[model samples]
Target: MRHIVIRNLGPLAEADVFLNKINIIVGPQSAGKSCLLKTACFCNWVEKRIQLSQDTDAFKENGVFENKFLEFHKLYGYVKEDSYIEYENDSMKFSYSWKTKVFDFSWKEEGRWNYVCPKISYIPAERNIVAAIPNWFEVSMKNDNIRNFMKDWQEARSVMTEDMPILNLGVSYRYDKSNNMDKVTVGDGVVLDFTNTSSGLQSLIPLLVHLEFLYTKRFNTEQSKNILRIEEEGTLISIIWNYAKNKSHGEFNIEKVYSNFTEMKRTEVFLEEPEQNLFPPTQGVLAYRLMDWARGEKGGFLFVATHSPYMVTSFLEKDNENDISLFFNKESKDGRYVVSTATEKEVQELYDYSIDLFHNLESLG
Candidate 1:
C-alpha cells in the first residue's frame, strides 16, 4: 500500500489516504478529488524519473520542475503558501514544500520494492473528446494531460485486434486502422461510427481501450521505451553513458542500468471521473472489473476519482472488500475539504441525500 498526506493544496485543505490495490475517491464538485489524484500521479512520475537518474538537476532548477511536473499536469495554480505533501510507498518516499518550491525524495535501495517501476497513465476527464475526434492531434491544445491521453488512445487503437464489448452493454467498440477511425457494433450487426456513439460509449471507450492496451503490453521493454518522452531521451542517454564510464572503472555494470530503463514491471493508472456518463448498474460492473484488473497482476494498481456512489457501493457488495480502499472528500465543520475513510454508513447517507433531493423535486410539482 502507498500512503500520502496533503495540506493546503487547491480545494483540499487536508487529506491522508492510502493507495491500495483499488482506491476510489468520491467527492462533490471542486472538492479537490482530482487535485489529490493528480498530486499522487505527479509524485509517482517524479519517483520514476529519479530512479532513472534524472532528478539531481531538476531539484536545483525549480522552474524546470514546475514546468515539467506542475504545469504539465495543469496543477501549477493549485499550490498555496502553506501547501505541503508527503508520499511513501514501500520503495520510495517523496515530500514537497510549496513555500520553497522544493522536492525531496528517498529511495530504498535494498528491498522488494527496489527496481519496481510502474508505468503511470492519467486518464483525464476530457478523454471523450479524443474519442469524438480521431484527428485530435492536428488541433493545438495547451492542456498536456488531454494531449497525452489522446496519444495513448491513438496507440491503443493500433493494438486492437478485435472489437471490445463495453461492459456487456450490448455494444462493441472497434478501430478501423485503414480508415483511421473508430466504429461501434450494435445488436443485429448494425454498425455506427464511434463519433455517432452514445455519450456513455464515448466516455467509457477511451479508458477501456487504454487499459487494454497497457495490459496487453505489460512487461514489454520495447513498448516501455517507446512511451518515453523525447525530452527524457537526453537523460536516458546520459544515464547510460555514466554507467558505461563506471563499467570501465569496474564500478558498476552498464547492462544493469540499461535494463532498469527498459523494464517496467507495473502499470498504475490514475483515472478521473471513471463513472462519467455511466448508468448505475454499469458503474457497479465497471468497479468490479477495475478491481479484478488491478489485482490480477502483481504490480497493477488503480487510483480512481469519481462522484458516483454506485462505484463505491460496489466494493461493499464484493467479498474482497478489504482489497479496496475508499476515501471521501467532503467539507468539514470548518468548511474546509478533507479526505477521510469512507464507510457504509456514509454511502447510505449519499443515497438518503439523493432521495431527499428527489422528494424536494416532487414537492415542487
Candidate 2:
C-alpha cells in the first residue's frame, strides 16, 4: 500500500501513511495503528475479492455494487457520516465513500498485483488464547479485528498433525494425552501437546504453522497430501478442529479445491505486538523470523504494529539494514492521533537513545 487516507474514523481525525514493503507501525495507546493496518487489509481484501472480471453488471448498477460492497463491511456494522478509508497507488484507487455508503473502487485492467491477489492474515496480541484451546468453535467478537484474527487462527491451527519442534521450558509438561496425538519435544525424552507448552510458544506456534502452511499452499502440496480433509465443511478450520477434537493427526493440507484461492503470488501479513509473551532477546528473533519467512516464502509484504523498543530496534540491526518503513503514531498538539513516517536512519537514532516507550493499544482501556 502506498497511499492511505482515513477520515474521521475514531481518534484518527485525518491521517495518511505512505507504506513500504516491510512496514512497521509504532505507537502509544489508542493511536489507531491497528485501525490503519486493518483498514488497509480490508481494502486489500476488496481489491482482491471484488475483481473486475465478475463486476461489469455490478459496477453499472449502483444498487448492485453497493449491495456487493456491503458484504465485506460486516465487520464495520455501521458507518457514520463522513467516515471513510482510502488506499491507492498508481494502478488503482480504493476508498469507502461515506456519503455514497459504498466502496469507490477504481482500477486499471492491467494492474499486475490484481492478478495475483495477496493473502492477508493477522497475528493478534490475543494469540495465546487461540493456542490455549485444543479445539474451539468459530468465536465471534464485537471487535472486528479480534473476530477476523480468530477466523485466521482457526484456519491456521487446523493442519498440525506432525510433532512440532519441542519448546524447552526447563521442566517437562503434559496434558491428558488422547490417541497418541502430536507432541512437542521440550527435553531429551520429554514430549507434550502444544497447548500445554509455555505461553510464548503457544503464541508463536499458530502463526508459524499458519504461515508455513500458506507457504506450502503457494509452492507445494494438495488435497491428496492432507491428513484429514472434510469435504462437508472442507474449510481448513473444519478439518483442523476435527483433528483437535477427535485426536487424529496426519499431514494437513489447505487445497485450492476447498478455498477460492488458486495459489499465492504474495502474502500480506499484519502482526500485532509480537513482543507480548517474548523476552527482550526473543523479540528480535521473532521479528526477524517474521520478516525473513515472509520475504523468503515469496517476497511478500509485512505490516507489524508494536510497542516494544526491541521490536522496533530489530529492524535497525545489521542483518535487516534498511529493509523497513516505520510509521510512528503519536497525538498531535491538539490531542488527535496523527501518524508520522520515518526512514530507517531516523528510527535507529531515535530508538537507540530513548528506550522508554508507551503502552500498546489494548492496555489503554
Candidate 3:
C-alpha cells in the first residue's frame, strides 16, 4: 500500500504518510501511533458497514469513530460555535456535511458516486480473537462457499485416517446450528479444545482453519490442469491425503497450525517490546511463532510498536542484517512532536545501548 496523507489529523498538523507491505510505526508514548491505528480501523469499519440510520452513539462518545472532518478541525484547534463540521478530501475532492443528528453520509467523485469505503480486517494489539471466534465461525459457515468447503474438509479428514489411529484433534464445535455442540475424545488422544489451550494457541485456530480451507480450494484448481495433461484422474481426497501424509509424516500436531501462523511462511518479524507482563520466555516464543506463521503465509511485514528491547535484540541476533526501525520522540524548537525513522547506523547504536543495559542489569545481580 502507499502512504496516505493525513492533513490536520489528530496531533498532526500535516503528515505525508506511506504504508509499506510491512509497515512499522516507531515513536515515543502518545505520539499519535495508536491514534493513527484507531483512525484506520474507524475508516475501515465505516467503509465496510455503512448505515446512516444506525445508532452511532458508541462511536461518538467513545471517540472510536469520530467524523473525519470534525476530527481534523478539532485536531487543528479550530471550532465553529454554530456551523457544522465540513471537510474535503483533496485527492477525490469529496465533501460531506452532517448537521442534524440523523443524516446520510455519502461520497462523490468527479460528479459521479463510487463506493464510499472499503473492507478491512483489524487485529488490534490487545489480541482479543477468542471472544470473537463464535461469531466469526458462524459467518464463515453461513456462506454457501464456506459451507461446502467445510464438507470437503470433513471428507479429507476421514480419508487421511483410513487405517491410522485418530489423533482426536481436540474438541471443536460443529458449525451447523442444529448440530451446534462440543466434540470431545476420551483416552490418549489429541483434543482440539481451545478452552484448554493457551490464549496464543486459541487465538490462531480460526486463522489456520480458514487458511486450510482456502489452500485446498486453490490446490484443486491448480492440480486439475496438470492431471489432465498427464492423462491421470485423481480426486481431491487422494491429493489431500498424500499431501497430508508427506507434510506431517502421519503425526500432525493440530496445535502447531495455530502456533506457527505468519503473514508469509519465512519472513522476519519485528516485534516492539513484547515483555510487558514479565511473561515467561515460552509465551514470548509462542507469540513470535504465531506471528511467524502469519508472516509466512502473507509475506512478512515489519512495523511493530514495542517497549521490550530484549524482544527486539533477540530477533536481531537471529538475523543480523534484519531491518530494525527504532523511534524516540523529542520536542522540536516549535514545541511540536517530530517523528523520525531509525537508520541502520542508528539501529546499531540502539543495539549497543541495549547490550550495555542488559549487561548492567546482569552485573547488579
Q: Relative to the true structure, how large is the alpha-carbon lDDT of every model?
A: 0.74, 0.61, 0.36
Query: Candidate 1 residues 288-307, lDDT tens each?
Result: 87777777663377888987
- Give me candidate 2's TM-score against the actual structure: 0.73
Which stretches in model 2 have alpha-carbon errors above 4 Å? Answer: 52-80, 109-114, 138-158, 166-182, 216-218, 223-262, 318-321, 354-365
TM-score of each: 0.83, 0.73, 0.41
In the range 1-365, model 3's lDDT, one tens digit per residue, is 32333333344333344344344454445555544443333343343323221223343443333344234212323322222322223112211222333323334423211222211223333332332343433444332222433443343322222122211333332222344422223245554433454454344333333333333332243322344323322232243345356554645433333222211122222332233343445334533543454345433344455445555555444443343334433344554444444556655655678746433322221
Worst 10 residues of 3 by lDDT: 111-120
- Scored by TM-score, the top model is 1
Candidate 2 displacement at residue 99 in angstroms: 3.6
Runs of candidate 3 with Cα error greater than 4 angstroms are 4-18, 26-31, 38-120, 132-303, 314-337, 355-365
lDDT of 2 by residue, 101-196 (tens): 665667663442234546677666776666575653444455445556666655544555554342233433222235523355676776767667
The per-prediction tally of clashing pairs is 0, 3, 32
